[model samples]
Target: MRGIDLFLTLVVMLSLGAVLWPFLFYPLILRMLTTRPEQPGQGQPPSASLLFCAYNEAVAMPEKLANLAMLKRRHPQLQILAFDDGSSDDTAALIAAQGDLVTLVQGPGRSGKAHGMKRLAVRARGDVLIFTDANVLLDAEAIDNLLARYADPQVGGVLGSLHYLGEGKSATASVGSLYWRIEERLKDEESRTGNVLGADGSIFSIRRALYPDFPDSVLDDLTVSMAVIFAGKRLVKAKDVIARERLVAARGDEYRRKVRIAARAWHTHGHLRPQLRRMSAIDRFKYASRKIVRWFGGLFILTGVMAAFALALRIAPLLAMVGVTLALILLALGLRSKGGPVAAVVDILIAYAATLQGVFKAMSGRTVTVWNPAKSR
Candidate 1:
């Protein structure tokens, strides 16, 4: 009985620790170890080529093109390139209408962003390749701010800050916004130390020459950004290179999006395993702490909860049962209401479950390659 108690206690603590360490302890440790400042880049901004892959984004095309035109006007040398992934809508037509303002690549079919990005990389003549999504809008000086970092020869890739809009509109959006804030903080600490783990596809740039070939099913932004580090260069995040995007307002849409992202992220990890093994010891620690631990966070959470229940049952079976039943009832009510603390908790659970599903799906030889913009976003 004592042995059982010890085992259960250890399992509960260890499992919970695995899940919480990334968010709580990792950043603290990172800050304590970080000694250097961000590379204050010098010299003129480099020429840039902006690239995005779109599919059935006709509604967003006009706004995106106008934003691009503004950026182009400010930097006359900035090259704008886009790929229409066989959209059934007027996406390609809108770009075609832009004429000289944009360079367009129309795919024969629904080739994924990885494929479109490869084509764009091949055609990109600028010194840097800036990758953004169709739905994400960049700030006016985002490009200039992104390129300004390139003045430091050590900086091979620059990740832009993504600020989510409409957090108060829905529980899903609020949860996402809070999560991204933590993520941005982690990225800041990582940048000060040595390298950021990787870039978000929403907005990030890499030296065109450093863009590496990756499998279509892999996460392109992660693969491309990590290649910068694999080549012995720094991948840093620039807070000033800002991009704004709306959060997925619907819980279901947000859940599916995370599932897809998590699945591709796992596959991308497998593809980059070789280079990952060769990274510096500290970087390896950061990767394992930030990425690997979080991938299994759902499983850890489950194990922890189960162990807690078992321990509670050992102490008082009747009270444990009553407590858990009440908790479940509360959770159900919260989920139905879809607002306030309870709803946010349920949303987080949904996110973790989705992440776990995606990880296991990838592990079982299934991978997500293509995705659509979240309609609610």
Candidate 2:
């Protein structure tokens, strides 16, 4: 019994520590690291290719391109390319309607985002490649801001700050939005330290030469940014170049999106490990702490809860009660948008089950190549 008690306590401590490390220790350590100012914007603005990947995004593409066109007018040297990844909808027709103003790559059929991006990359003929999603509205000066950072010469990529707009007044939207706020801040800190782990797919720019036509199974932004890091180049965060998109309002949709992303993350990591191993000790540590730990952080929380319960059974009932209470509070906060306590609890449980399913799929070597665009907010 004594042995069991000690073991359970240690397990609980370690598990909970994993959960708290990113929220507490990770940020604290980064804050302590002196903030490095970005290299000043230099030379002429690099000729840029504004690239877009679309699949069944007809409803949003027209508006998105209008914004891009405006951007093109501002920067006469900018080239625009749109790849329609075999959308069944009128996506191809819409791109065609843009005339010669935009180059359209309508592939054979349903190849997926990675393939679409690959096609776009081959067609892109610019010093810089600006990748934007079909739903994002880019600011007119986004390209200028991103290009300025490239003056440092060391920076291989620039990740733009993307904010969520129109997250309804729902409690769930607020929670999701707040979570992004925390995530973005952490990313900024990572950038300041000169070791950002990934870029946002919504809007980011990379030196054309550094771009890798990564495998279709890999997450584009992560692999691209990490590829830059692997080559001994810097990936900086450009908060001034902003883009806005609607938050995922439906809980089910949000859960599915997270699970799909989590599975892809697991797949991508296998390909990343070899590159990561060759990195400097500090770079390796930062990647593990920032990416690896966060990827499996949910598991840590799960383990902590189980260990706490086991400890409570053997040693203190209050331990289990406290764990349950905290969990209930979290569930309550998560459910605030879903309506009552019962619905929120149900959604939380569903989310957990979905997460477990995603992990299992990942472990089984399954990958989600096809994707459904989540319903707009």
All models: lDDT? 0.90, 0.79
Among the numbered candidates, top TM-score falls to 1
TM-score of each: 0.98, 0.90
Cα deviation of 30 in candidate 2 (Å)? 0.7
Candidate of highest lDDT: 1
lDDT of 1 by residue, 204-320 (tens): 999988989877889998999999999998999889989988888998898898899999999999999999999999989999999999999999999999998999999899989
What TM value does model 1 have?
0.98
Residue pairs whose backbone atoms clash in candidate 1: none
lDDT of 2 by residue, 336-370 (tens): 64655454454545544555667667889997866
RMSD in Å for all candidates: 1.2, 2.9
